[model samples]
Target: MSDPKLLLIDAHALIHRSYHAIERDLTSPSGEPTKAVYGFASTLLKVIKEQQPQYVIATFDAGKSFRAEQFAAYKANRPATPDDLKSQFARCQEFCRVLDIPVFALAGYEADDLIGTLSKQAEEKNLDTLILTGDRDTLQLVDAKTQVLMIMGSTGELKLYDDAAVRERFGFAPEQLIDFKALRGDASDNIPGIAGVGDKTATKLLQEFGSVEKIYHNLASVEGKVGEKIQAARAQVELNKQLVTIDRAAPVTLDVNAARFGEYERAPAVELLRELGFQSLLARLPGDGDGDAADLAAHAPQDIESKYAAVLSETDLAALVKRIKKNKAFV
Candidate 1:
């Protein structure tokens, strides 16, 4: 059997990109701005149709990330979220609720951190994991069992990166992405790197010396003013490393079973889409758009009563063993 695929979405990244991509505002029936909502919904449907993942979770950014606490100016350059797009965040979240996907966010971490934590957990379970995000910083999370689907363009063009793809794109392995970003600095996040280093210079430095530490260690050997620039910004380079690294252990606790994707009622979902004026998405609902009660009933969340439980006593254990034996033929 094929390995189960878990699709982890960076909700904030998608919503922000979707909000900015369109020139004109999109509004719902009541005139609430909904371009972000519409864009997120469309992306979700497209991913579902194409990837057909068996497990899914959408993660949103928690308030201010710990980075902001560490460096007050972190991401300070960005303007406030546009009110129109900000208003649509809750609607997009509700759409996730209607679709029965677990929504996750922690108090002091960004969506990328949650994804990193879950990706680690999924790695332990040996599941195939895919991260969908517009943030390039998430490239650090790619590994043997994990892949990042970087969403590009208004149409959500996906650039899939495994370790090999990351290497091909950046001239280094996925593991070096954090270090590369640290040296280059992320202007979008207001990070400061060496004074004059750009992507080409950063790439060349990494390719030659492997990492920031090594470059500094052999500062004398590095030729040119770029080497002097690296020495001058040593403190910023170290700080940037801390800022760029994704914390895989982000104090997130997930009910792994609850996160497992399951069938959910199609009627309510379609109803929500219709209410949102998403006629284009109504056709993609699980069943025909006839609003059949039977279809809804058939797809109701699985009851916990039928699930196996821990045997706390010998008698319970004996009963459970017998039940397992009884079902052995089917297995």
Candidate 2:
């Protein structure tokens, strides 16, 4: 059997993607914004059905991260979260809670850092880690035991990036991605790397020198304008490295067993979905309402690979309902 996979979700990235992917604004019965909530729920359910992971956890950015505190310009280029999307953040978190998934949100750490910490822990425990995120910074965490399911486009297509994929895309191992980003800088996060360096220059430099420190040691060998840029921006390059490197030892304690994807109670998840006006999703939950027959028919696993349906009729729904009878078990 394959090793138990621990799925770590970047809450804000997925929420932002969901909010924008959904063209029309959706609202709850009370008229509160529900677009992000619907998108997150739908995506989570879809992944759950497909991956069938034995564990799931979500990391959210609680407030200004340590990077922002250290560097005033960190993420400065990014706009403020939209009021509508902000309104749905709470509901999105509540949905995770209702699903019995463990959530980690450190006050001064970004979700990437928390995920880094957890992924490192998963490695120690010999568990496989899969990160679902749209952020490229996460690519730094991709290793043999840890892989990232990165969103490739606006259509929600995902590319599972492993060691080879990371090397192929970034032209270096996962360990050197921080150095590559440090050299090129990330305009999206407002991180200013070495002045004149860009992706091609960064990749070529890392390929030759292996790291920022090594590249500096061999600066004399590099000939051209790129050499001058690196010489002049030494301090900025170091600072950018500090800003881009993910802290794998963030001060957050996580119990691995607590994050195991156990059986979830259907009532609370169903109730939250109803509150968020996610009528279509209700069918995905076991014993959601009086629509057992309809739910059984609606979620009948047309893809066949889902294997969520063992039988064709109400028997399948009942069997699933029976399986999740335990408080912390999964159906």
Candidate 3:
């Protein structure tokens, strides 16, 4: 590929959004939960054709990680994936297999961190990286070299976000979104932020002080109960920042240039789509006149540098280690 353009799709975010957006309980021709499959397929095609990315890869949660041990309440509020949707992730992977897109996952980090690591590397290679995520937290990755294509609608509209857009939306710079999140806490991830802060208040405060550290360093500069409240919860805000910040430097054993996109053809992809009862999505995929062709067409894995070595190396790992105090950490 001569031009450098990469598209990073948030696999779990796509599936979760798909599961809820196309809320109809859909079963395949063989009776499988196909809503997510359909949504993922449709999204894949749109990204491939519209973004015309030179390289592409999707990241998923490996399910085993130390994030839980560092803190038990991380993501504690997201209700369990319904039995129905939980049943479909494997079939979704099968869909990825049939498409030939290089699917990746890692231990000790969520998909966002993987995407962040990949985006950082791509930027270094002079490649423009676009992150396709439904989660707002990934906005932290938005910069000149990276674009966050957040799925904004049920049918197929994407909110393309760059640094400017991130700045405009939250009144805080894109890099500062993590800080805003750190202060207010994220209920979705089960983070209990300062008691009274919400989005509006969080944005307002960050606009003034800039970051969690600054807000603390200059707490006396603020006014009203909010200032008193902030000082009171200073300890919690620091912890939230740690939780909300995606470790962009997380050690990765893979490469972005070596990522393959060969499976998105028109034939077998269509066959799999047909098998999954994803007719609406099938209608939207890259068609080969006769269909059943995997629309994706690139392939291979690349070697990635140790992006997280400085912060998460073996020698530094023990600093965050703690015994898993509960059984649900694994569940």
Candidate 4:
């Protein structure tokens, strides 16, 4: 058999994506908002079914990250999490709990760091890791033993990025993504890299120089306005490297047995889904072996030949209507 695979989920990323993907008015029977919860659960179940991972772990953002401490303006550009969405985080955690999936959330580290730490540990155990997230920052962690399952927000498409795939998309190795971000900057997270350096310049610089430090070391060789921009933002680029790189040494321990998938109590999960008014999702639960479960199996992405495929099913359509009450919300 193939080596067992571990699925490391970026809970915050999926929760945030879910909040925006589905209508905000989706709620539980008692009127508590559940758009995020439903979307997260649906995506989580979809991944578990598609990947058939033997182990699974979900990571969440607990509080301010070290990036914020290092750069006061880090991620300062994003607005505050809405009150409705904030309340749904606990429900997502609860869903993970009911499924017996271990949830990790460190106060000073983002979910990305936790995933990095866990994937590194999983690698040492000779296990393959599949990181599922909407964040491109995690692409830096991709390698032979580790790959990223990226969810496209616009089309809700899933794309798997191996080392080769990363190079195909970014024109450099996955490890070089940090340097690319350091030179190009990420406006979403408020990471200010070298000013005026865009994607092409950044890619060209990294492809030629390999890294930020080396690029600066060979500064004399770099000429023109781009060179001046790099020289001017030397300190900022250095800081951005620290901000962009994921910390693989985070202070979280991985209990391999605890993360073993398919060992949870099905009754509790079934009840929780029912309580959350996720009736259509009830049959999709792992090991359900029911009517729609077989149908759900056929909808999983069969291979990696194509970067994107439609994984939705008739049951999903029915669920979308049951949850959002409007077909347009999914579109």
Candidate 5:
């Protein structure tokens, strides 16, 4: 009776989060690192169990983005990806493949762009979309037809942001976040906005002026040192706007029907889990009766711990603990 829900996953965000959150040095039987793989699988399964989305799509960052080309210092502040974690990305893709979830990655674009494009496509098809990511950059995509399911770091807590939630948090519309970031800049991504503007100033400016373009048009009305800073960084703010705004027109196509959930081969999934030393997750896979999304939704929501307890025996829990304890180095 309700509109179908499509879950859009930001693979790089989750993978990065997982790599940091899982402090252990998890490895496969043959000694390959798998902490990122384990954490990603755990989080992914937890989302699927709780949301029961009718369709699912995952997006990954292919390589250097156009933003990096436009601005040489784009995300230059971040450290290089660890060799162990870098190796696990392919494993994450393999995990998605075994589950039959379609993944999109464009060399010239980040995963955010792919998600923006797909969410817009899903909206046009009359499907409701839920974007799952740890990155707040995707918050700008929240609208009536699309919501952002943001995963808090290490804690693994999820906060869903709809139109009202976005407005309530930022004191402005979701789209205004771009303008906010344009004024305040993002240290994580190394985007330098205005010279002396901070969060309070940016928020106040956006609350009154609406957008970067509007603020520039009404520069005379904006007085004081803050106004001077805005005037000084006019060109940088325009470039920041370009950097912060998600690309909704990314060159990626979405076939909604192909993304249908609960259609993967159960046998390969089980084997893959075994190979990766994820014995506990084996019980979480869908059984024959779970072929339909309606059937999955009919069941009441259960947290990851409850699901594991209901399906796994004490021996399984002990083995899981032992496997975790065996790892020493931090990821």
Candidate 6:
């Protein structure tokens, strides 16, 4: 049987989660921020050790990619990342680079879109997939073969949600996320919920009606001003649903399987992590090591037919630097 190919990790989500987790104490040698970096590298190492898939891709949001054009209110409440937090992003990339991980992002879409596109692609190719993102909005993409690995606070616990799991958590299927969000609205994204309805009404209404459009099409039976509200604001609700819904049909240009795990050199990745002060991460690199990653994940790069060490590429390093400079815009 072919190895399962998993795509997508919310790098920033993990980074930020990591930062806050060890917020009070973590610091670098030169008196800089290391909480996020340390946490990020540790989670990455653990993830690698746990889900040693044949393919992997770590994604992050590009600067101002979709906030202005899409909703003009997207992620509006997030304060500017402090200089400390900003510094860690580079270290995060450095960590990925040392591990030979491929990270992708485009100018017009958020990481959510990238995750959506890539997840859909993996499903189309019949690959069992795991999506690691702190954002609950991504739960909409969960399916039988595609499960969302959502973080459970800072306890290092994760809830694996497939079709049944998603139903259990959200009280409905993945398709209901759009309508659910539309009714409750996303305060985090500055979206206004239906004036009176909250989670209770949203869940109940969507459970009965299935989708926002369907609910509106049969709005007359709803109680009080609720029916009138749906009739009056039909356009906004539909648009909100459109905004919240994951775009599974997006033309994903990345060949997810191309970022195969077996291609990476474990030793160098370990060495790199060590250099970045990723203390325990090296022990987690997939290889001849005796671990769960050894069984489910193929350790060595299949592309390397002969038992010879591969040549490292300087051009790859230079290209990565260029991308960091371009997207990060930090000196």
RMSD of each: 18.6, 12.0, 19.9, 10.6, 9.0, 14.7
Rank order (by lDDT, best first)? 4, 5, 2, 1, 3, 6
Q: Write the per-residue lDDT of candidate 3 for residues 1-331, one digit (tens) a residue.
A: 2347888889999998998899577787777767787787778788887877777888898784566776797877678778888877787777777666677788878889889988898888788888988999899888889989999867657889988888888787898988988887887888878887778888877887788888888878878888888988988788888888888887773465457564355667666766776655655654343332223222123474543334457656554243234333522
TM-score of 4: 0.87
TM-score, predicted candidate 6 vs. hidden true structure: 0.81
What tens digits encode model 2's per-residue C-alpha lDDT throughout 168-283? Answer: 87779998999988888888999877766778888988889999999999999999998998999988889999999999999987687778775777767766776777878886
lDDT (CA) per prediction = 0.84, 0.84, 0.77, 0.90, 0.88, 0.74
Which portions of model 1 show Cα errors greater than 4 Å?
287-331
Best by lDDT: 4
Tell me the lDDT of candidate 3.
0.77
Better of 3 and 4 by lDDT: 4
Report the Cα lDDT for candidate 6: 0.74
Best of the two (3, 5) by lDDT: 5
lDDT (Cα, tens digit) per residue for candidate 5, span 3-115: 89999999999999999998779999889999999988998888999889999999999989999987899999999999989999999999998999998889999999999
> How far off is residue 146 in model 2, in Å?
0.3
Poorest lDDT segment (10 consecutive residues) of candidate 4: 291-300
Estimate, for each residue in 164-265, the C-alpha lDDT of model 4 and write its tens digit: 999999899999999999887889999876767788989998899999999989999999888888899999889889999999999999899999999887
Better of 2 and 5 by TM-score: 5
C-alpha lDDT (0 to 100) for residue 129 of candidate 1: 91
Residue-wise C-alpha lDDT for candidate 6, range 1-331, written one tens digit per residue: 2447675788878887887777475665556668788887777777777777777888887787443566777667778887788988887887776566788766666778888888777777778778887788888877776778887787757787888887887799887897899887888777777787778888888889898878877887797987877677777687688778765554456675467775666656655554555545545666654543443245345665555333369887777678778899633
Q: Which pairs clash in the backbone of model 5?
A: none
Q: What is the lDDT of residue 32 in candidate 5?
A: 93
TM-scores for all candidates: the values are 0.84, 0.85, 0.81, 0.87, 0.86, 0.81
